[model samples]
Target: MTSTDAFNTQGNATAVTDPHTGETRYNRVPQVTWDFWLVKLLAVTVGETAADLINTSLGLGLTNTSLLMSVFLIVALVFQFAQKRYVPVYYWTTVVLVSVVGTLITDNFIDNLGWSFTPVTLSFTAALAATFAVWYMVEKTLSIHSIYTFRREAFYWLAILFTFALGTSAGDQLAEGLGVGFLMSGLMYAAVIAVIAGLFYGGLMNGILAFWLAYIITRPMGASFGDYLSQPVANGGLGLGTIVTSLIFFAAIGATVWYMTRSKDGLEVAQD
Candidate 1:
């Protein structure tokens, strides 16, 4: 190439561009450790309780609540994608928003559209599996620790979105549809998670396997907990109202995120 052409290309590279300008532009994932899972569980719980609170307690109803929350999620996701690196606050905010969106997506399918939980659950599961298949094909890995590129980040969020959707459907099926109620369903999933944890700590299972299993189970567990608090007393819940439950969880999430930001506990090298 000519010297002038080379100089022009270098100038373009040095010019200020977008919101992502620093080292944070490159890393897309936080290290997968105990804190990661803990915060994740909190986010899912908040997602369930917060969504229910808005829809019921605030008298927004499912349809309106979904619309409002969906819009917020879109905004949050836009900001999240604009970031070049992993900011704990921004990342977790996106997670919490997506959790609510995921819940609404399933709720719309089952409640508004009059679809059955069985079909919805299976459909979302298939979709998530297909996402993983394609993501693995394109990225050659599904491990969260290695999510450093744009493509991997895309796959990561897509998978998370499906997990929330599938979890909502499954949780609803086992609780209300099957007449299992909220408490029992929560306990059941909690027990299963405990077993997975034991296996992982005992070295009888793989870390990634345990992580993914727990990740999937945490959704139903959180959903059941949310239902137990927000559902009416006649429905075997505390009648606390969805708004109260959601507020409580949202506050908790906010505090946790604040602590994480100051502590920088979950932000580090994600390499295994």
Candidate 2:
């Protein structure tokens, strides 16, 4: 999940604990693995459906739902970042909250502010680029493996929020603005992601680049699939309803997180 091997959850050195403080310190994020990708996809899918459920199905509207989810995200992240190492419950909870809020951000931008998809997409892209630029300038590395400090973790979360928002807007634009069906849009993004993976595995791409690229691409792909399944048949979806779709994804995420916790498969120890 860093500039190092993408699948290297544990580093060369063993974990360290501060004897004086009796606290363990390790990477704040999880290891990049198949389950990691699985949870990410599930989270993004739930993100799409959860936003629709709260805004349209529950009649909370975009603004209120955004405010409510934003609050929940802040609280969840407060708990997550407080940990010195990866904690599945806290970290995944934050991720799910972030995904929902990211969907809301895009929705509020286009629906409430009446901004066009092109502009919204461009804005989120620029914002993400700026965050990465500043992060690299300060830390000299954008490695996910180096997220052992507050500043790097801040940059990580900020960039993640932008990715979700960007993915949501761009996916909507392709799936609706251009009259591309949601299922096809999902397939298109998935195909592109597959190409990226092929390039990475073929040793033509940097690990960090491959990881982040896949991470970003999965957003649109998962969102598109979520919409296709949750929307009405008249609207090109399978008519499962947002509630059913959300429940399905959340259950999968729960099971995956439980596995990660039990196996300790996604954590890396931080050196002293």
Q: Which candidate has the highest TM-score of all? A: 2
Task: Summarize candidate 2's per-residue lDDT along 74-162 as a digit string, tens digits.
Answer: 99999988998889889999998999999899888888899999999999999999999999999887867668889989999999999
Summarize candidate 1's per-residue lDDT along 130-232 as a digit string, tens digits: 9989998987666665565577888989988998999889877877766788888889899998898788667687665676667778898988888788888
CA lDDT, every model vs. true structure: 0.76, 0.85
Question: Candidate 2: which stretches are off by over 4 Å?
Answer: 1-24
- Misplaced by over 4 Å in model 1 are 1-26, 270-272
